[model samples]
Target chain A: MSQKIEFENILRRIEEISENSKKIYGAPLIIDPKTGVATWYDQREIKIRFLISIEKIKRFFEALSRGKILATKCVNTGEIMFPPQINCPRDPKNQIEWVEIPNEGELVTWTIIKVKPYSFSHHDDYIVGIAKISNLNINILAWVKCKDPNKLRPGLRVRLNIVKREPENYLIYQLEPLEEC
Target chain B: MRRKVAIVGTGHSIYGVRNDVNLPELAYESIKEAVDEAKIGLDDIDLVVVGNVGGWSSEYLPAIVINEYADLAGKSTFRIEAACATGSAAIKTAVDAIASGEADIALVVGVEKMNESLTPVVVEFIGRSGNYFWEFQNFGLTFPGYYALYATYYMFNYGVKEEDLCLIAVKNHHYASMNPKAHFQRKITVDECMKSRYIAWPLKLYDSCPISDGSASIILASEEIATKITDTPIWIEAIGSASDTSNITRRKDFTGLYAARKAASEAYKKARLDPGEITRHLDLAEVHDCFTIAEIMAYEDLGFAKRGEGVKLIREGQTYIGGLIPVNLSGGLKAKGHPIAATGVGMAVEIARQLWNKIERGRQAPIKNGRGLAHNVGGTGHYAYVTIYSLTKPRG
Candidate 1:
C-alpha cells in the first residue's frame, strides 16, 4: 500500500507540465496562468547520500547490534554523555567508559509527526518521544510506540528497547509506555 | 578600543513564494534599496557579507553570484550560515570587520530562495539541520516536529492548552495583514487557526511560518562614516549569541530554549541593561517565531514572562501593542515570513525602520525607549542570537 497521493506524484505532475510548456515555449519555462508569473523549471536534480564517518565511536554501533544502548561516562568528572563521544569535552585527557543506558526512563516530552519529510514519506504518521534516564542524567529521542497520544503525557514512565526497524530492518531504539506494555 | 558600528541603511524584499525573480535579482532588490538609502554607491562598500543556506536553491556559490550580479565583484565577499540565523551571522561578520578597522563601510545581505525546489524537498532539507546522524538519520525529526516536542512538554508541564498556542498565530496574522510585505495579508481568527490541519501534533500548519523567498540588506559603517552617511542611524547596541548541543536528547529541559536564555542574558549584560526587565528597556521585539511554541518560549527566554507564565502573557495579549511590551510588531517570522537566511537581517531592517518611525502606519510600535530587539534562533535553539538596536549612541 502507498499513500493516496505521494509527493512524487506532484513532482511528476510538474514534470509533465514543464514538458508540455517546453514544447510550446522552447524552454522549460512556466507561466503561472493564474498569477501570470513566469518561472524557469530547473531540469537538473541532485540526489544526496551521505557516508558519515562513525569509526571513532564504533562501539556505540557495535552495542546496538548486541541489543543494548550505550552512553559515555567521563571517569574523572562522573558526567554522562549521550550520542557517546570518543573524547570528553571537559578534559580530553580524562578516560571514558561505555555504560549501558537504563531501559526504563520517564517520558519528558513527545509529539506525533503528522507531516513527515520527503525521505520519510513512505511511513505512516509516527510518534516521537524524549525520555530522561534519571540515573545517568541523559535523555534519548526515539519513536514512541503509541496510537493514542492523548493518553500520553510528560512524567509518564517509558522504557527503551532495541528492535529491528521494519522495512529497513536496522537496529534502532524505541520508547514504549509502561501502561501499554 | 573597538569602534562603534551603526546601520546607515536597510532594505527588504517582499516575502513569499517568489517565482517572479531569481536569487541575484532578488538579492539586488534589497541591495539597491540599501545602497540608495545609505546615499552611497556600490563602489563605497569595502566588504560584502552574504548569508545564504543553499541546498534547495540552484546557486551553489551564492555570494559570488550575488557579488557579480550586484556589481560588487571587486569587494571582499563571503557567505555565512548559522542555520536560519545566517542573516545575523552575516551582520556579525560585517560589524566585526568595521569594528576592527579592516573596513570603513560594509554591506551585509541575507537572501534565500526556498521555493526553488518543491515543498517536500525543502521540508526534508530543513529537517536535517540539527544533528543529522543521531536525530534525522534515525528518528527523522522535521522542523515542526522538533518544536512540537517542546510544545508538548510545555503544555504538559504548565497546563497550556492548544488554544493558547493558536492565539499566537492569530496575533501574528493580525499584524501581518497590516504589513504590506508580509506573506499573509489577511487576518485570521483563533478559531480559524485551531481548525487548521496539524503539521506536527500540537503544532498546526497556521502555527508554522511559511516557506518564504526573500532578501534583506543593511549597510554598516563606523561612527565617523555613519555620521556622514545618514542623519538617523540605528546604533548596534549589542549582539549576544550562543549555541547548544546539536542533539535534542542531550538537553536537560524542553520547556524553554537554554541557548536563547543564555544569549539574552549576555546581550543585556553587554548593554548594561537588566535582563529581567527587558520589556522596560526596548520598545519592541521581533522574536524567532518559526512556530507558535517558539514565540511563547521566546517570551520566557527573553524574560518577558517567568517560566510557565508565557502562556498567560499570550492569553492576556501582553505581546500586542498597548500591552505590557509589544513584540513582533512587524508580523515577525511567523507571518512576515521565514526566508531562513533572510530572516535575521529582515528583523534588523524592520527594527531599524521601526526605531526611526519610518514603517507602515498600522504595525509600528510606539518608540518610547528609542530601542528595539531582534531575537533570531536557528535549528531548535541550537544557535541563538540576540541583537539590540538603539537610536541613541551608547556610552561606554
Candidate 2:
C-alpha cells in the first residue's frame, strides 16, 4: 500500500471518530486514551499540485515517445547538455541542436533507496545510477534494474533503454548492464 | 575591496528534536544569549539577516515572525536561503552590509524546527531540493541516495571500506558524548555502525545526519565597533564561496565536492595560508560532516590529506583531538545534529567559542596560532562556504 494512503486512512479514522463523538456528546473534542489529554482535531485540509512548464524542451518528451534519447548540443562550442536544454550557455547567441545520445555508456556509481520520500511512497525500493555516455559528453541519471547493488562495479559498460514503467504505463529510461552479470 | 567584519558575539541552541519550543521561541533562545554576550540590545542592531529553509515547518515568513517576537520589528530584515548553507549565506549577507557601511552592527540568526513535521514529510522536502523535476520527480532520489552515489564511487575507485566510513561516525559520536547540547550524546562502536540497517546501499543509517531542530545566532560588528565590544572577537578572516551544478550527474567527479575544493582554495588565498599546509596553520576545524563520506572528502578538499588519503587519516585516528588538527570537536552535524539552516551558523559559533578558549575541557582543541576553519556545504555540493576565523586581525 502507498504510504500516503496509509497515513490518509489513519487521519480519516480520527475524523470519523470525532464526528461520531460530536453527534453523541455535542462537542468536537476527544480525550486521549493514553495521556487523558483533551484535544481538538483540526478539520481543514490542504491539497497542492504544481503546474510546471516544459514548453521550452517539449521535443525531449516527443522524442522519448518515439524511443529516442535526445540531448541538446551547443552549435558553437559543440558542448552537449543532457536533461536537454533550450539555450546554449556558452554562446547565448548561438542556437542549440538536438542530438541523439549513444545507447552505450559506462556505469559510474549507483545507490538503492530503501527509505523513500512521501511523494515516492507508491514505488517499491528502486536503484538509481549515473552512467557516462561518451557520445553525449555527459552523465545520465536513470533507474538501474539490477538484482543486487553488490554486483554493480564502477567502469562497467552499460546501455540506456526505453521501457514502460510497471503499474503506470508511462515510458521512462533505464540502464542495463552491458557486461555479463 | 571593502572594510572588514568580525563575529563579536555568538549563540547556539541545543540541537535535537526540539518539540517543546515553537519557531520564534526557539529563535529567541539564541538571540537573547547573543545579545547578552554582545552587551547590546535591539536598539543597537542596524540590520537583521535570518537564515531559514521553511517547507517542513509551519512558519513561512520566519524573518518577520522572529523580528516581531524579538521586539526588532521596525528594523530592516531579510531572509536568506541556500539549502543547508543558509546560515553561512546569512552571515555573508550581513558581512556585506557591514563592509558596505550600510550597517555597523548586524544580527545573523539561523533557525529551523524540522521536528514539527513527520519524518517522511521532511525527507520529501529535502529530496526535492535538487533538480526536482529532472532528478527527483521521476527518479525519486532521497538525500542519502545522492550521497550514496559518492560513497559507492569513492569506495569502488579509492578502495575505501565501509568500516572506514564507520570510523567517522564513531569519532564524531565520541566527541558528541561530551557535548551537552548534542542530540545523540552516546558514542557508538565501529561494530554498531556497521551493523546498522542501510538507508541507502553502502550508506548505513549511522552514516547519515538526522533531521534536527535547533537555532544558532552570531552578532557581526564592523572592524571599529568590534574591538570595543569584546576583548576576544573572532575576526571573519576570509570567506570563500562557490557552487556546483544542481543535478548530480553534471559533476565531473564523485570522490570529492568540486565546489568545496574551489571555495577552500579561494579562502586559503584570501587568508594568506597555503592550502597544502592548512592543518599546520590552524588549531582546529569544523567541517560539514552531513555524512561520513562528506567528512572524508572535506579532509581532502580542505587539504588536510591528499586525494584518496583522507580515509587513511580517519583510519589512523588523526582527526581526533590532540591528533593533527582536531575536527568536529562540537560533535559536528553527525552527532551534534544538522538542523539544516542552523548548521553553518552552528559551525561558526563552535569555531568562535574554540578561539575564545571558552569551550568545555576534553573536547576543546588547544588554541595555537590563534586560527580556525569552518567548511560548510549546502545541498550535495550545490553551495560551499569556507570561512577562516582568527584571533589576529586580517591585514587586508
Candidate 3:
C-alpha cells in the first residue's frame, strides 16, 4: 500500500476511538496512555486545494506538451526567467520574449525525498535536483531520473527533457543524467 | 533621536510535542509568566504583537484568541509571519513601537501549535511556504528537501563528510540533555546520528529539528518605562532584517544565505562591533539551527567563520563553551525543538536568562562581554533577522 493509504488507516483508527469515546464521555476525547492527558480530536475536517491562475504564462504549458521547455527572456535587460513570467520586474515596459531552455546543463545540487508530503505520499521516492544552464547562469529545479542516486554528484552533466508524469498523467520537465565526458 | 528600547521581562514554554494543551493555553503559559515577571498590569501594555505561522493550527486568528484567553482583550494587537523567524519579527515590531514613542510598553509573543495537525499535513504546509507554485507544486520539495540541496552542494564543494554534519547533531543534543525544556534531552552519539536514515538525501532524520508546539513572550519597554520596571533590563542594541527572492532558483549560489549575511552586517554596524572580532564582543549566540547544515552556513553568514570554514569550526568544537564563542547553548532548534514562530522569541529568552546567569549549569556560557546575538532565519533564508541584546544601554 502507498504511504497515503497507511496514513489514512491510522486516521481511521483514531476516528473509531474518538467515536467510542464520544459515546461514553459525551465529548470527542481520547486520553493518551503514556501521559494520561485528554485531547479532543477535532471533528471538523478541511481539505485545501488552490486554483492558481496561469493565464499570462499559458504558453509555457503549451510548449511543454510539444516536448519543448520554455523560459521568458526580457527584451530590455536580456535576463531569462524560468517558470516563465510575462512581466519583467527589471523592465517597466513589461517586454518579454519566449526562448527554449538550453537542454544541456551541469547538475549543481540534488536530494531524494524519502519522507514525502501528504499530497506526494502516493508516489515512490523521487529525486529532485537543480541544474545550472550553461552560459545562462540561471538554475532550474526539477525531478531527476537516474539509474542510481549514488552516481549523482555536483558538476555531472544533465539534459532536460519533457515527459508525461505517471498517475497524474501530466506533461512536465525532468532531468536525465548524461555520462561524464 | 530614537528612544532606547529594552526587554524587561521574558518567558518561554517547554518546547516539544505538547498535545496536552490547546493553542491559546500554550500561548498563555508564556504570556502570564511575562506579565507577572514584568510586574505590569494588563492595562499598562500599550500593544501586543504576536508572531505565528498558523496554517497547521486550528486557530485562524491567534492574536485575538490569545488576547481573549490571557485577559488582555481590546489591546492594540496584530500578528506577524516571517516563517520560522516570526518571533524576531514580532519582537522587532514592538521594539520599533517603543523606540518611536508609539508605546511605552509592548508585549511581543511568539507561539506555534504545529502538533495540532498530522505530521504529513504539517509537512505539506511548511513545504509550500516558499514559492509554492514554482518550487513545491511539481517538485514536491519538503522542508528538509530544500536544505538537503544546500547540504549536498556544500558537502561536495567543501569536502565535508556526513560525519562532520553528524557532529553538529551530537553537540546540540549534548547541550539539549542539560536543558529540561528541550525536546530531546537524551544525548546522542555520532554513531547513532550516522545510523539514522535519511529523510532527505545527505540529511538524516537526526539532522532535522522536530516539529514542536511552544510559545515565548517578552515585555519590551521604552527607556523611561524600562528603568521603572527592572534594574537589569536586557537592552535591544540593534535589530537588522532583510529578505531574499522567493524562488531559490534566483539565488546566485547556495553556499551561504546572502540575506543572513546582509542582516548580520547591518546589525554589526549598528551595534558598533567589528565583524572580524565578533566573538570578543558577544558572550554567546543563538543561531537558527533548523538543520545541521544550516548552523554551519550561519557561522559563515554571521561572520563567525570565513566562507568554507564553518565546518572547520564545528570540527574543532570552537562553538562549544570555553571555546571561541558558545552558540545555541539552549539546545537550538536541532535539539530544542523548533516551534515555528516561537523559536526567535525563545532565543531572546535564552539570551536574557544566560546573561542573568540563571540558566542550567554545564550549558551556560561564561558571560564576559554581557552581550548576546540572535540569528533567526525564516524559510531557508527567504527572511532573515539579526538582533543584538546587551546588559548596558546602547550608546548613541
Candidate 4:
C-alpha cells in the first residue's frame, strides 16, 4: 500500500509541474506534498561525471584486473603511496615506481553502515574497514567481508584480497580475516 | 607586530528547521542585531567575512547575497569554508584582517539554510564531505556511520555501554529544554534515546545532532576600538587551528580526533596553559558535540578528562554546573541545533555572552577564571579550531 501510494504521488507531482513548464526559466515551482510548502525547485540540473585522467597510474587498474593491489614507491625517499599518485610531494623530481601491496595486514578500525546515502541506497548494510599494511607504512580502506563486528578487533590479523565485485563484476579490493573461522 | 582583536558585539538567531524565513532575511536577523549591539552603522564596517557551506542551500554565493541584503555591498567581503568549522575560519580571517591594521572593525557572519534541500539530499551532501571519491563513492557511508566507527571502537575499548552515550543526549536535551532558541527544546530521557532507532550500529537517532538552518554574527574590533566600544569586551586571547589528512583511511585511530588534539594543544600553548591541565584554567567550554560520541571524545581531546575516561565524566555528572569544568551550557550542537557553518560562530556568540554574564539563570557557568573555550571541528576531524575567549586583555 505504501509503495503504491508513493509511486502515484511521485508520478502525479512530476506531471503536474512539467506540464506547465514550456522551457526552463531557471525556476521550477513545486509544492511539497508532505508539508504543502511552496518550494522553487532548481530547474538547472547538474550532472557531474568526471573524466578522471588515470593515464599516469594506468598500471594500478591493470594490476587490479589481474587480482593485485599496487602502490607507488618514491625512488629517492623510498616512501610508499597508496591510492597511487604520479608525483611524489616529498621529492618532486625523484623517480617513482609502482609496487604491489603486501596482502598481510592488521585491521585498525571497522564500521557497519546501517544508514546509506542517496547514491548508495540500493546496497545492503556493508562493513567498511581500514587495515594497516606494515611494510607500506600506511592504511588502506576497503569493504571487509565479515559477518559479525563482535569478532573484529583493532589488532586482528587480516589480508587484502583483490576480487570481482558481484552485480557489477568490477575489480575491487576487500579485507578478509586471516584467522580460521 | 600584529594588534590584538576582541569580540565587541555578538548576535545569534533562533536555531531550528527555519522554514519561515528566507536565506537573506535569516542572515539579516543576526547582522542587524550585531550592528545594533556594536553601536555601529553600515559605514563603520570595513570588511565582511561570511561562512557558509552552500551545497544544501539555494544561494550559491551567499556572501554577496547577504551583503547586498544587509546593504553592506561594494565593501570588501569574501566567503570562507572549512566544513562545519567555517564560522571559526571566517572569524580567524576577519581577525587577521583587523590585526594587520587593514580593517579596524570587521563583521563575521555564519549562516546555513540546510532545510532548503530535502533530508535525503542533505544526508548525501554531508556524507560526501570526507574524501568523496575514496569514502562515500564506494561504501556509501552516512554521517552517522562515520561517527559510529568511533562509537563502536570506544564502547568496545572502554567497556562503556550504549546507555552511557544516551546519557549525553539526555543532558544536552535537558539544557535545551531551558533554551528557548534550541531546536529540540523538549527534554528527553535515556530510555527514550535508547528506544530511538539505530541510524548506525551503536549510534541511535538521538546520538546525532539535527540538520538545522540558522545564522549567527559577531562584530570583531581591534583592541583600541574594542575598549572604546564596550567595557566588557570579550578578547580573542588565542586561536589555534590545524588540519588532518583528507582520507579517513590515512588516520592512525578512530577513537579520537587527532586534529582536535593538535588544535587544543596549540591553543593552550598560546594561552600559556598546559594542555594536560586546561580544566584548571578554564571556567567552561562549548566543544563541538555534533554527535554524542564526538562530545565524549572532545572531553578527552580538550583535556577535560583522561583518555578513555570521558564516559566516566558523563556518567558521574562531572560536566554539569557544579562539576570540575562545565561544558555545553548552551545545549551544544547536539540539542542547540547544528546549522553546520553557523555552529562555530554561534559558539563564539554564546561564549561571549557567557563571559559578559548575559546568559539565562540556570545555564550560566560561573565566570571565576574569566576564561572560556570553544572547540569546533570541521568534517570528521579534517579541520579543527580551538578559540579562547577571555574577560581580561591578553598580555604579550
Candidate 5:
C-alpha cells in the first residue's frame, strides 16, 4: 500500500479516457470518478527544464564532481556562504574565496517525504533535511540517508558526502548520520 | 498626509474543489456581490488589483481575463503575486495607490483555480515555489514537507505531541462546519486527523489545506468616497509586511517566522497597540493556517502566546470563542480551502465580516472593541502581511 505509481501514469490514463470521450462526445472532457465532476482535459503539456547560469560560482559544481563540498567565504568580513556564491552581500567590493565545506555537521532539522512531487514519486519515501556545519558556519539542504526515521533527530551528528543520484545519475551532496544509532 | 481607507464592500465565493466554474466565472461570483454591496457601479472604481498565483490554471493572464470578462477592461489594472499572500499583497498595492492619492477607490480580487490540473500536477507546481533550483530541483520539497520541517523542530523544542497539532485542525473544522462558504463544512475529529496518512511526516493529509478553487474580492475607498459609499465601513487600521530568506537553509532558525514577528510588531506599532495586550484591543483574529503547525507558529508570531507556549493555547482551547481570542471563525485555510492567492483576501473578507457581526450564527466573534486582525503568510515564511481591520475610523 505504501508503494505508489508515477503520477504521469495516472495522467496518461486520464488522457486516454479524454481521447475516447473526445471522439464520442465532441469535446475533451472526463468525469471525476469521485465527485462525478466534468473537467476539460487540456490538450497541451509543458515540460520545464531551467538553464540556470552558474558561471560566477562554477567552482562549486567542479568541487562536487570531485566529491568535495565547497562554500564561499568573504575575505574581508569572514562571512561564509554555503551553496556558494561569488559576491559578498554586505560589501559588494569584498572578494570571495571558494573553500571546502567541512564534511562533519549537526543535523538541525529533517522530514520524511511521504508524499513527494510528481517528479520525485518514483523514489521510495526519502528524508530531506538541513545540516549545520559549525566549523564551516554554513547550513546545507539535501537528501538525508537513513534506514530508520526515528534516528534522524535534530542535533544529531552527520557527515556530508557527494554521490551520484540514482535514475538520473547526477552528482549531488547528501547528509548521512555519522554513526547509526 | 495619507488619506484613510476603509473596506466598503466585500465578497467571497463558496470555497471547495470547485470544478464547476471557470476562472472568470468564479471571480465574477464574488465581484458581482462586492459591486452590488458597495452600491457602486464598476465605472466608479479608479483601479483594480487582481491577486493570483497562477501556474496550474489555464489562463496565462488572469487579471486581464477577469477584467475583460467583468466589463472593466479599460480600467487601470495589474496583477500581483506574493506566493500565498498574493491577496494581501494586492490589497496593500491598492491601499498604497489610494494613500498616495493615486486613486480614490480600488477593487482587489484574489482568485485561484488550482483544481484545473490534477492533484499531482498541482503539488508539483506549488512544490517548486521556493528556491526552485537549490530546493525543489534537488531536494524535492513539497509545501507540506517544508512546514513539516518547522513542525519537527517545534515539536522537539516544545515537547508537543502530534495530537496537539491535530487539535488546531479539529477546532478549525468545527468552525468550518458552520461557515457556508468554507471548503470542508463537515467537522472533523482528532481521531480522524490522527488516522489520516502523512503527506509529509509530522504533517498529515488533514493537517494540510486542500487544493481549492475560489475567489474573494474587497472594495476599498478613501475617506472622502468611503463616507458616501457605506455606513458600516471596515477601516484599514494598520498593515505591516515583511519577507524571509528564500532558501530554508538560509533562514536564521525554524522555531517561528521572524518575518511574521517583525510584521506584527510594525502593525502593532502603527495601530498604537501592544502585542502583549492584543486581545484587549481586538475582538478576534484570522491567522494563516495553511497547515496546522503553521497556525501554532502564528500564535507565537502574532504574540498571542509566548515562545514554546502556542501549543498550550490549542491544548486548552484558548483560541476558541469566549477564550483568549477566537481564531479562524471562517474555518480558516485549514477547512475554508486555501486557493493560494485567494486565501489572504479571504482572510480580509472574514475579518471584515466578523467585525461587522455578519458571520454565521455559531461562529461569529463577539465584536466588543469593533476590531479584528488578519495574519496572512506567504509560502513558508517567504512573505508576511499583518492587517488590522476596525469599525471606527482611524485617526488622521
Candidate 6:
C-alpha cells in the first residue's frame, strides 16, 4: 500500500481505539498488530515543511526558468561551483559570478530508485544519476530519463535537458543519454 | 597530559522491532546492564554521553529524557549525532572526557527507535541526510539508492558481479546465526540473497541493513579506576575520525569512501600499526556493513586489501573466521541490525566481547593479537570513525 493510504488506515484505527479507550482508560491507548505490545498513541499530529531562503542565489533559479543551468564561479580563484554558492572561501576579496553549465556530459554513476521515500512513493520508480559535465571539474546530480537502466553505464554520453516535473510542476534539469558514445 | 581510558563495561539489547518499550525504557535496558556489569551505580558515573540521531523518533532531547529515567538526573549529560556514526561519536566523546581528566568515569549510550515511525517516514528521514536541497529534494534518492550509485561505479570499474555482493550478505548472516542478540539469527544462502527483491538497482533487500530499534551501552573509566572495576578492561588504543562533503556529487571517487581511508590511516599512525599488513595485527573487525557494497569498500579503505582487490577477498572467502581476517563476527550491521546511532557502540561492545572471549563460541575469533577494530561510517561516507580496541595497554 502507498504510505498515504497506509497512514490514513492507521490513523482511522487509532481514532477508533481512542474513542473506546478514552471512555474506559481515559487515554489514547493502542496495541501493536505485529507484537501485540501496548502503546500510548500520541494525540497531537504535526506537519513540518522548511522555508529555505535562496535570496543570495535567486539568479540560479531565474536562469533555470529561462532554459539555462547556472553555476557560481569565483572570479579571482577561477573556481567553479555547481549547486552554486555566492561566496568563495579561498580568498576574502573574491567575488562570485554566475556561469552556465555545459549541455553535454558523460554518465559517472546512476541508480534506479526502486524503493523511494514516502514523499516520492506516489511516483513510479525513477533513476537518479550523477554525470560529469564536459570540460568541467564539477559534477551534477539529477534524474536520468531512461527507458532501460540496464543499458546505462558509466562513461555513456548524455546531454542536459530542462523540463517541468509534473504533479509538483517546477523546472528541473535532467540527463538524456545520447544514442552514440 | 593525556591519560589512558578503558572500557570497563559493555551492554547490548536484543536488536529487532522492539515495540514493547518506549524510548527511555529501551535505553534504560542497556544502561542498567552496563552499570551492573561495571559494578557501579548511577552515582559512580561522572558524565553521560548519549548518541541518537532523532528525526523519526519522538524524543527531541533524548539524553535528558533517558538520563532522567535511569535515575541519572542532574548529571553532566549531552547527546551527539553524526548520522549513523553517532554511536562511535558518543564513545569518542566519553573517551575524550576521561582522557582529559574531565571525568574519571563516564557512560556512553547509543540508542535509536527507528521503528517508532512508519518505515516510509523513516526512509524519508534518512534519505534527507545528505545535501537535501541538491540531491534528495530534486531526485528523491533513498539511502539504498545513494549506496547503489557507488555499487554501480565500483562494479563497472572492478568487474564485480552481483553474486560477489551476495557473498557478503551470506557471510554476515552465517555469523549472525550464532549471535543471540542479532536481529537476523538464521543463516542465509547466496541463492537466498540473490532471490531477494531489490530495494535499489544492484542493492537487494538482503544487501541492506534493517531499520532496527535497539540500544547499546559502554562504561569508560580512567586507567586507575578501570583496573579496579574490571580485570579484563578493553583499552581504547586509538580512535580516528574524519568527514567528507555532504554532497555526493562532489566526491573525488565513488569506488570507496575517501574519509574512511584518511581515518584508517590516522588510526594506524596513532596505534603505531602498519596499514599494509593491518589484518595480521588485529584479531577481527566489525565494519559498518550497512550495505554489502559498504563492507567491500571498507576492506580497501581500511587497507585490508589493495584498490579493486576487495572483491577478490570476498570471493576467496578470506574474510571468514580462520581466514586472513574474520570480519563482522557479531553479524555486522547487515545481519546484527543497524539502530542508527546505536550501531557504533554496538560495534565497540562486540569487539570488546570478542577480545575477552565472552561471545558465543561459533562466531568468536581466536584472539591471538589481543586486538580488534571497529570501522563506523555515517550517511554514505559523510562521516567516518575508526576505533581500535586492545587487551594490552598502549605504551604511548
- The worst-scoring run of ten residues by lDDT in candidate 5 chain B lies at B115-124
Q: What DockQ does every candidate get?
A: 0.88, 0.63, 0.88, 0.52, 0.81, 0.83
Give me the chain B TM-score of candidate 2: 0.99
Q: Which window of ten consecutive residues has the lowest lDDT sum in model 6 chain B?
A: B114-123
The TM-score obtained by model 5 is 0.98
User: Across residues A34-145, which tens digit of lDDT does each residue of candidate 4 receive?
Assistant: 7765556555667666786778888998988888889999999998888788888889786899899999999877777766665665566788878899978988988888
| Model 3 lDDT tens row, B1-396 | 799999888888998999989998999999888889999999999999999999999899999999999988999999999999899999999999889898999999999999888999999999987799988989899999999999999999999999999989999999999999898899998999999999998899999999999999999999989999889999999998999989888888989999999999999999999999998899999999999999999999999999999999999999999888899999999999999999999999999999989899899899889999999999989999999999989999
Q: Which tens-of-lDDT digit does each residue in B1-396 have in candidate 2?
A: 688899988888999988667889999989988999999878999999999999888778999999999999989998899999899899989999999999999999999999767687888999988899889978999998999999999998888999999999999999999988888999999999999998888899999999999999999999899999988889999999999999999999998999999999999999999777789999999999999999999999999999999998898899998788799999999999999999999999999998888888889889988999999999999999999999999996
Candidate lDDT scores, in order, read 0.91, 0.90, 0.93, 0.87, 0.91, 0.92
lDDT tens per residue, model 6, B1-396: 889999999889999888898899989888988898899988899999999999888999999999999989899999999999999999999999999999999999999999888888898999998999998888999999999999999999999989999999999999999999999999999899999998999899999999999999999999999999888899999999999999998898999999899999999999999998999899999999999999999999999999999988899999999899999999999999999999999999999989989989889899999999999999999999999999999987
The candidate with the higher lDDT, 3 or 4, is 3
Model 5 per-residue lDDT at B252: 85
Question: Could you give candidate 1's per-residue lDDT for residues A1-181 as a string of tens digits?
Answer: 3332577787787788899988999899777889999888888777789899989889988998988899998998888889888677787677899999989999898888878888888888889889998888888899998878888877899889988888888999999999863
lDDT (Cα, tens digit) per residue for candidate 3, span A1-181: 8779989998998899899998999999878889998888998987778899999989988888888889999999999888788888878897999999889999999999999999999999899999999777789999999858989988999999988888888888998998732
How well is each residue in B330-389 modelled by candidate 1, as lDDT tens digits? 788889899999999999999999999998888889999999999999899999999999
Runs off by more than 4 Å, candidate 5? A1-6, A33-36
lDDT of 1 at B221: 99
The per-candidate TM-score of the B chain, in the order shown, comes to 0.99, 0.99, 0.99, 0.99, 0.99, 0.99
Q: What is the lDDT of residue B260 in candidate 4?
A: 96
lDDT of 5 by residue, B294-369 (tens): 9999999999999999998999999999999998998899999999888899998899988888888999999999
Instruction: Residues A72-169, candidate 5: write the lDDT tens digits.
Output: 89998899987677889787677888888878899998888888787887788889899998987778999999998787778899989888899888
Clashes (N, CA, C under 3 Å) per candidate:
0, 0, 0, 0, 0, 0
3 versus 4: better TM-score goes to: 3
Q: What is the interface RMSD of each candidate, in Å?
A: 0.7, 2.3, 0.7, 2.2, 1.0, 1.0
Error of 1 at B184 (Å): 0.6
